[model samples]
Target: MLLQTAPAPGAWERLLAVLKEWDFAVFLKINTVWTGAFGDFLMPILRDQRTWYPLYAFLFIYVIYKFRWKALPFIIIAGLTVVLTDQVSSTFFKNYFGRVRPCNEEALRGMARLLLDRCPSSGSFTSSHAVNHFGLATFIYITLKPYFGKWGLLFFFWAAFICYAQVYVGVHYPGDVSCGAVLGVLLGGFTAWIFKKYFNFGNRKRGDLTTASPTV
Candidate 1:
């Protein structure tokens, strides 16, 4: 006869306590919306990926102008960064966590101040917006850090604001955004590092990660 070992003392309880605390904090923020202007500003920025098409196209074009054909490889890797972050955050993490989005929460129906009249019909433990943008930001930052120095940091701030907008619109909790951002950073930073190492970026031996970093 074997004796079963008990789970770590109070560990589950502590975890539950932390989750409850976070949910309480989320409740506070969801009801704080104050302006039509804010919603107008954030909705366009937060929901529509197409809204940034011109900027994305401009970046691709600008990179090509700066580095010519060498820019093609980095642009491809950038696409991968978006795919990794968006898919993992939305498909895997959201389903695995199975937490209901604030917008979809029955209890929050009356309480949460919504920007759009509609909410997506999906699980929302992780914010896809945060993940995609942050991941892209991290990749871009690492790729261009050598040439642009401290200026590359702006990408992280840009990603953060997008995540904040998700919370403001009552779609995701702050924890969801925070966790998504962490995952994005890891995915982007690790991928960029790998690209650099494999491509011999330090010596520019086999087409380094960057030929000329753009100021934009």
Candidate 2:
């Protein structure tokens, strides 16, 4: 007789099972409630690093004043890279994949009770918030690493917080956040590198190049 193996669970079924597990359920409930109560409120605030961009711009301007006019072009290039990469990832990849939000699926409907409210019927799989925030964080951290030294780790935490907030709010899956983070890091780093090589932007000491830290 031929040996038979058990079939693998479908993606949706696996997601449901993961959601049903005790630890994950607890996290899901806590995150759902916390994010639900404030998810929308916080989303507008944290969605883009745009709010923080002005502050960074001011800082970079100050750096230019302290350093040299050459820094202006670098700052402008870094800022534009962050903005463009973030917009492309959020607008194109997130929508193109067009995965359904976790709470919107019938397979996971029972887990909905743990959610603060129904998940939005928008595209999922990759979180815009995660992509934008992480992308910005990665770009900024890489740009400033030469100056901040170990302080760069803080940006990783900042990105992680933003990405986790997505899952907590029931808008994305762990997998979605994970993939978004990876994409964000790659895009952010690539953008930064391109500007550094072509435009000679930011602090581009040859040794300063580094990979983006993981989030989620």
Candidate 3:
């Protein structure tokens, strides 16, 4: 006969208590109150990666033209950062945690302001959008900060805006994006550090690694 083991006392209750206190209030406000033409126009665009291809193409061209061959390692770092964030957020966090998305929550069915035409059929504990955007932003900024100064940091705000749109569009909760942000920042820093120290990516001086020449 197998030995009987007792369940941990208040485990479920403790988890519920944390979730209850984590400000689902702000989530409801952002999802419901932020609706309008700007959201109508921007949220769907934010949700679709294809919509940003032109921007992506331009960014790569600018980086390559500005930094030449030396920028290749940094580009690889950014690509890996995004891929890692996307995979970790979806496969590990979303699948393992299996939290219900706001649009799919039974309690929020009528109330959650879903802007997208169709809701995703996946869990939303940690948003892949937030992870990928923030991760890419952080790693790229880290690599390019010396080269572009404060201007390089703008990518972070862009990532933040993208994450905000997720909450407004009702695809994710604030807590989910928050977790994703933390994860992204960590992973981004980690990747940047690896590239710098182990991969012979060179020193903090932009001139030492990549050219400071202005593009035409």
Query: How far is each candidate from the true structure, as Cα RMSD in Å?
Result: 5.8, 7.7, 4.9
- Per lDDT, what order, best first? 3, 1, 2
Q: Which ten residues in a row have the lowest lDDT in candidate 1?
A: 200-209
Tens digits of per-residue lDDT, candidate 1, 1-216, equal: 998998775988999789867775765554364447767676656656776678678778876776666676788888988888888987899889898888888866677776766888787878898888888889888886665578889878878877777777778888888888999999999879766765412322235445533322
Q: What stretches of model 2 exceed 4 Å from their correct place?
A: 1-64, 113-121, 201-216
Which residue pairs show backbone clashes in model 3? none
- Which residue pairs collide in model 2, if any? 35-39
lDDT of 2: 0.64
Q: Which ranges of candidate 1 are over 4 A from the true structure?
A: 1-9, 30-36, 43-47, 200-216
Tell me the lDDT of candidate 1: 0.75
Candidate 2 residue-wise lDDT, 1-216, digit = tens: 988999989999988677546434554664555555466567545534465667566767755764465566667766676677667766787688776676675666666432334456667767766676677677767766666668877877877876765676566776677777888788888866765566543444555444222111
lDDT of 3 by residue, 107-149 (tens): 7878888788888999897999888888877787776666667
Select the stronger candidate by lDDT from 1 and 3. 3
Q: Number of the top candidate by lDDT?
A: 3
Q: What lDDT score is found at residue 77 in candidate 3?
A: 76
lDDT of 2 at 136: 67
The backbone clash count of each candidate, in order, is 0, 1, 0
Top of the candidates by TM-score: 3
Query: What's the lDDT for residue 130 in model 1?
Result: 83
